[model samples]
Target: MGRTKPPRLDGESEDDYYMRLIQKLANEKLALFARYQMEQQQEEEERKEVATNLLSLKKSKKSSLKRKQRDFDEDDVIDIKIKNKKKKKVGVTTTNKAEQRPVVVNKVTEGVKEFIKNKMKGSDLKLLIQKTLYASDLNPGQNRLNMPANQLETNANDFLTADEMRKLTDKDKKSGLEVDKDKKSGVEVGILGPNLRMYDRMLELKIWDMPCTKNYVLISNWYNFVKEHYNFLKKGTLIQVWAFRLNEQLCLALVCPDHEDDNVAFEENLHDGENDDVAVAASASEV
Candidate 1:
């Protein structure tokens, strides 16, 4: 045998075996080349897999970063909006405070003085009122004959004090009336003590029309007349009064019994329209 030849590929076609001798001459080199090509292909596949994993990780990181950034931006916007709203509220409160102003209350006594000055222009009534209000007659023995009405009315405690009188005079300057500021009613009513004696104070008679509530002049010097007709100033009798500012003292312009009609006969009556149940029961038994 010529050096033993390597076995041929079985069932080799003419094309397959055409360069058999040449192939056999470089077989060792060819085998080495084939192994090198296979290793190169395997390395390429491993590199592609590694690159894909790295790319996926990078993409995930980028997406996470973008999401975090977006949330941060939204939070920043919300914070800015809240701050703006607070600023607006503060501005409104400040503006409101600036707009508000204090109200000025007028002195009540000033208006009454002006009214007295205007109404009693011709008469020396203003001087008399001043004297009547301010005259201090603590010493009963001295000048007892010319003492003020206030001194004569033994129940001075039942009357308004000096400070109270000041407040009352300062309450409503336009109307010399100590009106019920809370009630806002045009009509003002007050009860006087039984021992009240009006010696020099001006007085007028006023008749009340229950249906119309209109005051009609009936007579003057009503208090003086009450002394003569003692029955007219009876207990629980309703009287209409018009208060005035006499000097610095509170005075009444008119005071008279309230009447539904002109048949002005006075008698002691039950207090505050209260019915006498005993009298009614007695009448029933008589019936």
Candidate 2:
């Protein structure tokens, strides 16, 4: 007969015995390996789906940024074209205005100058030209002491006589010398000489000639005269001043720079002296 089958445990059926043996065998080996493999495959599939979604999101962001940049570039191009057109319009308007503006000319000044040129006499015109040239050549703070030759040669008697002055002083009468006197007080004309100085718009001149002795004249009048001939008034220049005392103060009635020809001669003499000195020095050096 065949080998006898193993006996079952107490109270165990034949099917229960086979099922327990199989469960014990599976526990000893790999019982749930197929189930673990199926779970890993599911996790891999979820990771691939997440990666694909992230890639699509990145592509959409890039495309949106490119579209925004393209719109901005088009707007910039339109703005640049509009500005260029406006500038061209403004330039055309300015050019038309400049072309329409009229030119102006002065005729009165030219006519007046021509009239003066025609009216002036020969000797008078020559003298005037000389004076104008001299004045033009003079720098500020420098002066030319030039007077009419006739005025310089006038005798002291012609200017004022003692007898005439006495008559004018006592009687307040007009003299032959045209010495102006105040009618209220009969005063003789006095003379102001060289060494004149201006102080605070007041001219103070020392009196050395005529009847006055050791006196100084503070001239308050003749502002216009002084202003007109200001360039001629120089220090150490001979100024023949016709003045009279009013309230014990000398009032300058008339004044003029005199002896200009003599001053010119003196300057020439000085220049010659300087030349002589230079010649002597040169000769001495040669020796």
lDDT of each: 0.31, 0.31
Model 2 steric clash pairs: none
| Stretches of candidate 1 exceeding 4 Å from the true structure | 1-231, 260-287
| Candidate 1: worst-modelled 10 consecutive residues by lDDT | 128-137
Candidate 2 off by > 4 Å: 1-158, 161-164, 171-220, 238-287
lDDT of 2: 0.31
Cα displacement (angstroms), candidate 2, residue 256, comes to 8.2
TM-score of each: 0.17, 0.17
Give the per-residue lDDT digits (tens) of candidate 2, residues 1-287.
97345567999998998887777558534423422432343234324434544455556675536553434333353355345534653112111122221222123222222222332100111111011112211223221122222222233244334653454334424553423222112322221211121112334331211111111222223233335445654433233323233223322222222433333432343234233332322232232
